[model samples]
Target: MELVPFKDTGKAPAQNFTGDVYVTSIKTPTEPSRLTAALVRFTPGARTNWHSHALGQTLHVTEGVGYVGTRDGKVIRMRAGDTVWTPPGEEHWHGGTATTFMCHIAMLEASAEGDPTTWLEPVTDETYQSAGN
Candidate 1:
């Protein structure tokens, strides 16, 4: 048993997100592991750019309402305690609702080798609005 050091809550880079967002590292496997966890917070109307992990990702909502959208224009509305999963290489984005702040614990599987996360273009406003907020 050990206590890992806490990381600073810094703004999420625009390179991977749209609008203002922040993330704090909760756990990062040092060796013989490929799992990572983060506590991500999104401001109202903020969200991630379309992206996917090589192995997949899971999100567990902890507060407020969250929006999850897929490449096919399907948006899932999630509330506190809700859990969502994105299969390997599936394009999607997740974030806060238009009028609420949102936070979730993101679990990502690190690629073994040669495979990496594929990031796609940003989600357009037209598609965002279609999610019905």
Candidate 2:
């Protein structure tokens, strides 16, 4: 195995997130593989739009408080050591709390057709308001 160089991809665009968000690539599909991973950092109140991974996705929280929610309105409160797994094609969104910056290691595998994630509409204010810190 070789060391994969880390790349700072910079802040996620507002179109894909509600507030300031950043990502650092830890690993990418090297070839003949679909595995990819990144360290994602979210500013307070920042969050991803509704999305899902093709194979599944694993999130390991690295710092501060974060929130992950599903369509059915089940919001999971996560801390620095928390780990969460979202099954394949299960639409969801995650982000930092209103008052805290958060960071997590996001790991997922792309499908054979080179599809890794499917992005849906942004989480509405009505939906996000229902979440708990």
In terms of lDDT, which candidate is strongest?
Answer: 2
Alpha carbon lDDT at 3, candidate 2: 70
| Model 2 vs. true fold: TM | 0.94
Worst 10 residues of 1 by lDDT: 109-118
Clashing pairs in 1: none
For all candidates in order, the CA lDDT equals 0.87, 0.90
User: Mind giving the per-residue lDDT tens digits that candidate 2 earns over 15-44?
Assistant: 778889999888788677778989999999
Q: Itemize residue pairs with steric clashes in candidate 2.
A: none
Candidate 1 residues 47-90, lDDT tens each? 99898888889999999998999988888999999999999888
Candidate 2 Cα misplacement greater than 4 A, ranges: none
Number of backbone collisions per candidate: 0, 0
